[model samples]
Target chain A: MTSEKKIRVLAAKPGLDGHDRGVKVICRALRDAGMEVIYTGLRQTPQQIVKTAVEEDVDVIALSILSGAHNELLPKVAGLLKEQQAEQISLLAGGIIPDSDIPYLKKKGIKEVFGPGTSMNTVIDYIKNYCAR
Target chain B: MDCLCRKISEEKERWVKTTLNKAKCDRRTDENGEDIKVLYTPDDICAIDYLSAIGFPGEYPYTRGVHASMYRGQPWTIRQYSGFATPEETNQRYKYLLKQGQTGLSVAFDLPTQIGYDSDDPMSEGEVGKVGVSVDSLEDMEIIFRDIPLDRMSTSMTINAPAAVLLAMYIAIAKKQGIPSTKLRGTIQNDILKEYTVRGTYIFPPRPSIRLITDIFAFCKDHVPQWNTINVAGYHMREAGCTAVQEIAFSFSNAIAYIEAGIKAGLAVDSFAPRISWIFNTGSRIFEEVAKYRAARRVWAELLKNRFGAKDQRSWMLRYHTQTSGVSLAAQQPENNIVRVAYQALAAVLSGPQSLAACSYDEALALPTEKSVRMSLRTQQIIAHETGVTDTVDPLAGSYYVEYLTNEMAVKINKEIAKIDEMGGAVDAIEKGYIQKEIEERAYIIQKEIDEKKRIVVGVNEYLVDEKVDQALFRVDKKVARQQAAKLKKLKKNRDGQKVQLALEAIRRAAEGNDNMMPLLIEAVNAYATLGEICNTMKCVFGEYRASGWSGR
Candidate 1:
């Protein structure tokens, strides 16, 4: 393993989804991949997550929301990232996103969407490829 | 023909020599240090005693199960955990669940209610009804179970930190219904120790928290004999990234601590041990998950009888509830969650849980919509009715592979328990961040395996396809917060202010003295003192617990 600059990721659970098994698993997967990950516990607001993303200067912001407020919440986070001029940070999201919402999320600048059954390798590959690009 | 033959031969050779070869490999170690054996065999379980280890269901040590008839007697209760928005809305949901043939009601309170913040508290802003049902006062609790009979239906409230307050409120509601407190049958997830390690919704330090728990245990034994004062949980810890063995070890350690605390408070083991229950998370690993449950029962029985010197068989038996793993559900291909949940539920039933909560298929995307929740309940219904898995108790009991794994699991878990005891128990381990760090490390390793493609998660990294489907997702109304805040304000306006003050002061005095806080808390709940107000009063006296090391800098 190269001792290169580790790809830093902010794994955040926005809104009030107290069910966090998927998020915890993903967080572990990313950390094991040798990426520097900051887990901001649970019940974070979209604004709080964006604020943390900016403060941590993370290379990617991964939002884990199973709370069905993704349509309202994801756009807000994307908007705040732009307003804060942190658009360089790739936005990735996981949790149950309906198929119809993927294009909408993509339109809002979420570079990749890793849904259930998406292997950790795919996420790691997507981040590595997207970040390099 | 020659060119086609050559290409075909090359493809066939590659599949036969490499792909098939790799597929047959055994015992691959994942990043989390978990061994993924190709297949478990009788040889793997050489140490198990057929009669002793895989005992008849509902027998001593309860390795196979606690009930000999198991699900055939009565299929595990289908208990769905749901609460959202305001008490009125939650009441509607509860009524709907009861109508859907759900055997028991499991309530989920919002963060504000859990942390003892009033609906109008600054921290409660924008989060009043986002996650769970919001209960600001006894008025809210009265409305939550409004027309429902507390005497008829068993309820499980998934609340900690403010668990005693909520329990007191339930008791007050029961008293108002002319039902003696002793007749109520329900459970409070008074598992505060797990909160610090995994769930993170804690109010006071370990000492005062354990005191609060012991107070409830002591009071319940004498008063609400039918009520379960605490549900020692490994569900959150497993969801938080612990291995199956670690989950059992950590949760049992927590249970031991609670027992020690109760004994210290001058209570006998049999007085409340039967009422002490467990909640575990059933995951994707079908056999491993089943083995974990069976192993848990055996470990608990040994610990209670041998270690604690308990004479009562009821004190030795481990009764538990199982919830499908929320962590295994994915955001993509959300429908796949249905199959995953079915497997988890099946594991729980076959492993022999007292009750099971199947997670909704839409859980990965949002709070479950009515349709999704129904489907979840239906999944359990199908297993109970259509499948003959329930016809036999511990159907997989005699399998050499299962018995061996159960024994191996017990040994591994006992080792961890010894480590925790050396560290002065679960509370001490949690305080020192040992448990938290270990879980985080394990979580990291599991993820690493997936990142490297060592673990195959269908629809996520492999067998990929670009397809999308629309799912009905639940959205919390923005109006929920405003409505809840208004109700809190109105309750404050109408309730007797002086009685509330006296009740609060009584609670403070009880906290200082050796008196149990339940009776005073019941009085406060009856006076319509808001949950936040009661918690704030306790916080002032007890102070909030911050992990000694986590400055977050």
Candidate 2:
């Protein structure tokens, strides 16, 4: 634990959905997990989120969308990150996304897709495990 | 006082120790963990004044019910609020709902529209018509209300930040339908205060948002006399995981802020107060919710009459719409939600709401399909027609436990409201982040409770399930973006561009001054101005709101 660097996570809401419940809860958990968290508030575009993740040099980039715009918005953000040469940052997605769409989001570079009932422990462990990987 | 009451109270201790010990059932507390006594007798509510505190229905204080007849004269309006995909699709849904015996129209606009964006805007790219109907301009509004006569129907638009723009669009549609503003009967969720405090759909900062809301109040008092100016909301706060007590207190405090703002803006109390209605969430907490509605009515009635000097009885009545709790619906064994919704609806009906929108069973998975939505509506119908629950007025009014809980909730809520008032009111409290923090703390507690399996949420917690979600879910059309964009482009190209520009200029000019912006808003939409155009004009004057000191964020 002493040898591990503090994980910097960029938590962002990448759509017009104002539902900050899930994102805020996750951010609090990440911070409590001894991670440095930078929260970009609601209505951030794909490019803006990716740029923030890059500029902050975050180890993990977490995105939440409840407005059913994940398929269109998630891929755009992931693609922009790769284009911006910030693909090293692990991308994760969460919120009211359907199970069927999880395969597409995963294929598009979202390392993890957390749904409604996913425990905070799972999220923190995922970040640690992903970092280890 | 009575022999049976005394015996019950005396025997309850022995009953708890002997019978209940074998039962091993825990004592029931509220969502906030407040004590709930096993049996409430007259001694429990001895402090309450029946006539003064718990007055008769339709009378002062309105603790029992708002109208004397309650549902006997007229049952609560069955309002199933929904929309998604596109305007045409939404219109088809609206027509279907109306044909299936729904009494009212409640519109749910998409995220982009709710936040005041056109379908073609870059901010609206992927969210064209996902959460609700997308109305880029008057064209969409026209399609939404086509062949549905405005004068004959009552509509409720679930919008907040851009409520003024949407209301104007509705007015324009009514005008085209040959209905005058005075004849239009409905409400606009023109509650920007709740948006700033709880929900985050706001476009302008609090000050200007209040100004816009007050403008609507003044404007509607004169023009749209039949319209409810604002549906002051506690539902969203409750959905955000506030306790029933906090929900009532915080919402009342917000309502107080609006009333004060309206009066300070030079409108008399009676003129606008009658149009003030509320929306509350009826959750799984059956007695607590009924008591919440009851307590809210009494508190509001007294506040209007005493605090604000509202002379009219209509102003004192706390008429509210109810929605069965969305948070209570679980994704696990989604079919279980129907039973949850039925009880919630029953609680709402027992407590008396002006209307209700029961959540569909499949809502926890995705947007409701036609079959699920119909079942939701039928849930309300069964309660209204077959359940025999609506046959009595204030059915639970005189019950010892109900009265005791109502009094308890009212006192607690009023105490909290007093603290907020001492802090200079809701807006100041929100800016200070007190309200948001309170809600966040409660939300965190509830979430943890669920996670730790302390609260048994049926299929979610205690009752485990190994099942697949095989329900055919309603998926939004991906092509809606392109289709709406093309339509918006064609409409912008074809409509009288000069008239639109001129109308937008009028709104910009109105935004610069203290003048009421409602008329200009209506004219702009009527002249084919897009929602974004109107909101942008105001944004130039009242720059878009950026939340600050958000410790949670």
Candidate 3:
């Protein structure tokens, strides 16, 4: 069931959060795992992230936010993707997110939430499994 | 001495040849990838003269420590970096911390404030008071320090890019409190070079950013003599995942650029060099971190005295503040981070810094609760009062491994600094994305090592834990954003609009021309103009900076 096409993903940092260490690391790891990663750089608003994802036609949007703005921002991005009819793209998140906030993020359409100490392998595998399914 | 050295070298060679196994000889790299030998004796640091190279504390080439008495004179200040939510809440927290025996104040402005955006700005959505206090005008600053006396408290604000505006607000508040500028003692993290590389709060481009920094240097020299105009920080760089040696080299290179910029701005080297402080990150690799600090002091002294020709004794000293690394903390076994923080803080103390902040154990997850922050401050207090390690100055000065590592670290750090110098300096290197690429490569490797289990992180990679722990994490109230916006609205309604317009115009004129900006900034803040107004006035002239993204190439 291995697909011939490489997975296209967009890594976005939303809401004025500039802790890019996690996002950049995930981007590099995604690229290394044979997926195309387009980093939106630091400080992209939710609208900008959705617009870029829809325009670039990415298969997935991975949002990273270390600043505690995820509660408001993650849902906004999900809502925007739904409004744009781009719900096919899987959404993921990682950063200094507390465990208590994970359920809310998942309910808001984030497929999975990765906290600190998550291995790159786990992320790559999740993407592969999701694509295969 | 030469004959004795030869005899010892021969004896060491003979011992290695007879006793060492192949496995021991095959491994030559230390944790940070530096080459290391099996043993170290007098032969390793034989070339470093004791007096000229590794001199006494408070002397030239201060390899041991900066002050003669060190902690014996006075313990390093317990300066925990804290601020969250509205100005009133942060003010309450400040009072609580001071009552809990915190000595100095280190303010952390929210991201919008750091980037010069008002709470109501579209760019500030969902971000006001998220990470730190949101200050839109002098009114917010007044609330942040409502009852705290400016003259008695030594404050350090972690603000860059818009550091000038924040300092002006601080001075304006002090004036309202009837305190003169001379009585103000504090530091502003005005180091913008790293912003282009790692921190990412930069506003203006490199040339104009350096211009603003130099303006502060000159302004502080004449007006606020006691204020530390800039804290040349490598802490953020290290947190973004550079090695200890790279941290020292890169930060020192940035310092060199600032010194050069100040001299070019028609100021004497010694006049502004003494007020340039530093911020560094200390990690859990105890010996290496300690050696890194020692080598950093020696190399900085040599650079200031010999290269920059700074004549003042104060100019030769490398006074720094150290913070325990937050990246080293793991969320799985949150309690383990306490031990990690303790070890890292011990390393910073052993190396002799002017101030220290131990990261709370719960910071790996979210904002630390009051209980965790109290534990963090208690960690520093324990090291200062309980641990006997601070009984003397530079206790591990003459150890063979520590000295060898310190000397070797200096050589490696100098080599890296030379590479950056050849690229024309920190600004040029950052412009070319050279520094960013180097840091990414190191950071990637570090993460890869942890992933592949080459490096073992307790309770993360090695030990398996299957437990759900419910802990109360401090969450900034979402109401903070609305409240801050309302405050800004009320202030805009009450303030003298014409006077604000006039002050902002003056700022714009000064920013466009070759003029010192501090006096004009103070005037603008006193007129009750918002931070966004002042920064936007300059932004029209300086323009915003968009970094050429590093795609990990």
DockQ of each: 0.23, 0.51, 0.62
* lDDT by residue (tens digit), candidate 3, B146-238: 999999998999999999999999989999999988899999999999998899898988888899999999988887899999999999999
- Runs off by more than 4 Å, candidate 1: A1-133, B1-47, B547-553
Q: What proportion of the true contacts does each candidate reproduce?
A: 0.29, 0.33, 0.57
Residue B159 alpha-carbon offset, candidate 2, angstroms? 1.3
Candidate order by lDDT, decreasing, is 3, 2, 1
Q: Which 10-residue span in candidate 2 chain B carries the lowest summed lDDT? A: B544-553
TM for candidate 3 is 0.98
Predicted structure with the largest TM-score when compared to the true one: 3
The residue-by-residue lDDT of candidate 2 on A58-103, one tens digit each, is 8998898888899999999989988988888999998888888899
Work out how many backbone clashes candidate 1 has.
20
**Candidate 1 per-residue C-alpha lDDT over B58-94 given as tens digits, one digit per residue, 9 for 90 to 100:** 7778888887787767767789989998888999999
User: Per-candidate TM vs. native?
Assistant: 0.86, 0.96, 0.98
lDDT (Cα atoms) of all candidates against the true structure = 0.83, 0.87, 0.91
